[model samples]
Target chain A: AQSVTQPDIHITVSEGASLELRCNYSYGATPYLFWYVQSPGQGLQLLLKYFSGDTLVQGIKGFEAEFKRSQSSFNLRKPSVHWSDAAEYFCAVAADNDMRFGAGTRLTVKP
Target chain B: EAGVAQSPRYKIIEKRQSVAFWCNPISGHATLYWYQQILGQGPKLLIQFQNNGVVDDSQLPKDRFSAERLKGVDSTLKIQPAKLEDSAVYLCASSLEPSPYNEQFFGPGTRLTVL
Candidate 1:
């Protein structure tokens, strides 16, 4: 079974500051990774996905994530996060045809 | 197009009561899923349906949980004699296919509080 781990439980950053959230996956084969964001009392929205092709994938809301095979990591990054980016982020890995999610990391933006 | 739709945004019931949730997946989607998310934890897949057929339901608690998709379009998840631990957010998602690589659209989810 594939599993994902999010090292950070919560991350705080000021508006306009850069942000990075770490994600690690345990899979035997080529992993299909994804990042998703969820606001308060809402369903999760897809951020980005890495299947093949480029190591870095861009998503909506100025979010991007890099898929590194050697380190088994796919970390999400934002050059300058906005106040609206404050939400819970989840990292997921595809196992067979099922997807497993991480515990998630909550992002807090300070003014 | 409209996204996935789920009914009963919030429900509060006492333990041992029964509850049900409805979900309407996006048109033409072949895969539907039900997940349970506890506070501070990620969503866990309880059951999956592929065109009205059961695909995966290994994690579902059969004794208390039951789900069905009629006509391969809409779904309903029911919990009988709900336990206190059943209090959580139940999310419904749909994808174009049974593959996980395909993008999945999520509904707003139904929050259940078992007192």
Candidate 2:
């Protein structure tokens, strides 16, 4: 079975600082990777996804992720974080016609 | 375009009771999915429907959970004799197709609390 791993459980970053959320997946073949953000009491919204070409994929809200096949990782990065970026981030892998999500990483932006 | 719609923003029920949630996907979407999201955890896929047929339901607890998407537009997920562990937010999402490449739009979700 395919699975996604988010090493960080919680992260606190100062406002306007750089942010990087690590994600790794275990799969045999080429994987479809995705990043989603969920605010409190709300459903998840897609941040970005990597399907094929272009090792780096840019998504909504100035977010971007780099798909590194060698390490089986797709880490989300943002140059400067904002207060509104504080939310739970989920890394997911899609395979076998199904998608599996990681435990999730909670991001907190401090001013 | 309108996103997915889920009914009963909140529900409270006793353990071993029955509960149901309704979801209306975006018009013309061919794929619909149901997910269970526990507090502090990511959403877990419970079932997936393509049109009016079941496509993937491997994680759904068939013994206590049932879901139907008749007419291929709206869906209903029912839980009989709900347990305390079933307390979580039930999310509904839809995509243009069943392929992994399609982006899924999610609803606000129905929060279920079992006492």
Candidate 3:
């Protein structure tokens, strides 16, 4: 069973500030990783995914995540976050066809 | 392309009552999934269907929960006697295949309140 851990329960950043949300997973082998965002009253939307190839995966809304095998971490990053980036972000890991999600990190953008 | 569709955006019911949610996946998707998301938590998968066949229902509470996909296209999830703990958002998602790499499109979700 694979599990995802998002240490940050909430993150606050100013508009146009750099942001990073840490995500760590516990898996024996290389597992499929993903980042998803959910706005208020909206469903979760896929941000990016890492299966086998690239270490750094780019996603929509000017966000990206880097998969570090040695650290068992896949942290999401954004150079300059916008006001619209305020939402809940979830990290998920899948292995043996079963997927698990983290508790999620809530992002708050300050004006 | 149109995203996944779920009916009754919101519902309110008392404990021990029954509630059912309807979902219609994308036109060409072969995999449909139902997930429960409690307040302040991430979405947890309840059941997964692969073209009308049950692929996974391990996390679903079988005692009072039941789900079915009659035609492999549309699905319905029912709770015989809903509990207060069952209050949450039920989300429907679909993907082109059953693989994890396949991107899933999600529906707006149905918010259920059990008082």
lDDT of every model, 2 decimals: 0.95, 0.95, 0.95
CA displacement after TM-score superposition, residue B103 of candidate 1 (Å): 0.4
Better candidate number, 2 or 3, judged by TM-score: 3
Give the Å error, residue A25, model 1. Answer: 0.7
How do the candidates rank by lDDT, highest first?
1, 2, 3
Give per-model TM-scores: 0.98, 0.98, 0.98
Candidate 1 chain B worst ten-residue window by lDDT: B97-106
**In model 2, which runs have C-alpha deviations exceeding 4 angstroms?**
none
TM-score for predicted model 2 compared with the true structure: 0.98
Reference-based lDDT, residue A89, model 1: 98
Model 1 ranges off by over 4 Å: none
Q: Check candidate 1 and list the clashing pairs.
A: none
Per-candidate RMSD vs. true structure?
0.7, 0.8, 0.7
Tens digits of lDDT, candidate 3, A1-111? 788999999999999999999999999999999999999989999999998787999999899999999999999999999999999999999988788899999999999
Candidate with best DockQ: 3
Give each prediction's DockQ, rounded to 2 decimals. 0.85, 0.82, 0.86
Question: Which of the CAPRI classes, incorrect, acceptable, medium or high, describes model 2?
Answer: high
Model 3 C-alpha lDDT per residue in residues B2-52, reported as the tens digit of each score: 889998999999999999999999998989999999998888999999999
Stretches off by above 4 angstroms in model 3 are: none
- Model 2 scores a C-alpha lDDT of 0.95
Which rank order by DockQ, best down to worst?
Answer: 3, 1, 2
